[model samples]
Target: MCNARGDEAQAVARLGFLEWAFTEPGQVTAETVKDALRHPATKAPGSAAARAFVDYLRQAVTPLSAGRARRGRARALH
Candidate 1:
């Protein structure tokens, strides 16, 4: 049952990504995320998953826009 649920969730996510890609081709580049995460520094201590999420977000949005979005997220967290 858990496996089935996970598969369904993954399918939904995949469809959503396809829609997003079609809507905004400029975002969601592997290079963008990689560069964003690697740039400035990588020394911030955290779980591997957190670091991975940062990289994923960087790649998932426009560079400038993502930076602004991240700032908002940071403020919200605080």
Candidate 2:
């Protein structure tokens, strides 16, 4: 996910999210992700920019997560 557009703060946030998501089983909820985004350490670099970046990430990831959940359920039924 690293790219030129992603500055150090954004990279740190993303890494933190990944760590949180993988550290525990079933810990990747929207609320948890938002919590990580708003975390003091993660937001310390630049609150406004981090907030905006996280908002964008929320919009993009939420639907994909929902869709994945739905697909997992569908597969279970079959």
Candidate 3:
């Protein structure tokens, strides 16, 4: 999923990102992905889901490090 999709543009972008990551591991972080991202399809979250999403975000931050890790779960919203 982190990699690009099947398209010339995406593949080119993916290759560039990969090269950057390899050459500059320190700089190529989550921010790199965030920076490359522009006007993501999903809208920003709001207070409507805060009660449930807050804690979920806190304890549910999964590391991007390579290794096996189970996904975290949040309390039921309802």
State which candidate has the highest TM-score.
2
Model 3 error, position 38 (Å): 12
Total clashes, candidate 1? Answer: 0
Model 1 vs. true fold: TM: 0.31
Alpha carbon deviation, residue 28, candidate 3 (Å): 4.1
lDDT of each residue in 1-77, candidate 1, tens digit only: 11223445455445644664567547657665455456554446243443443444454664444788899999999
Q: How does candidate 1 score on lDDT?
A: 0.52
Per-residue alpha-carbon lDDT of candidate 2 for residues 1-78, written as tens digits (9 for 90 to 100): 333244765566566546646784775676766666566645543454454456555663565448788989999999
Top-down TM-score ranking = 2, 1, 3
Q: In model 2, what lDDT does residue 58 have?
A: 67
Candidate 1 residue spans exceeding 4 A from truth: 1-4, 25-28, 31-78
Candidate order by lDDT, highest to lowest? Answer: 2, 1, 3
| lDDT (Cα atoms) of all candidates against the true structure | 0.52, 0.59, 0.40
For model 3 the local lDDT of residue 18 reads 51
Query: Which regions in candidate 3 have their CA more than 4 angstroms from the true location?
Result: 1-6, 25-28, 31-78
Clashing pairs in 3: none
List the lowest-lDDT window of 10 residues for candidate 2: 1-10
Candidate 2 whole-model C-alpha lDDT, 0 to 1: 0.59
The candidate, 2 or 3, that scores higher on lDDT is 2
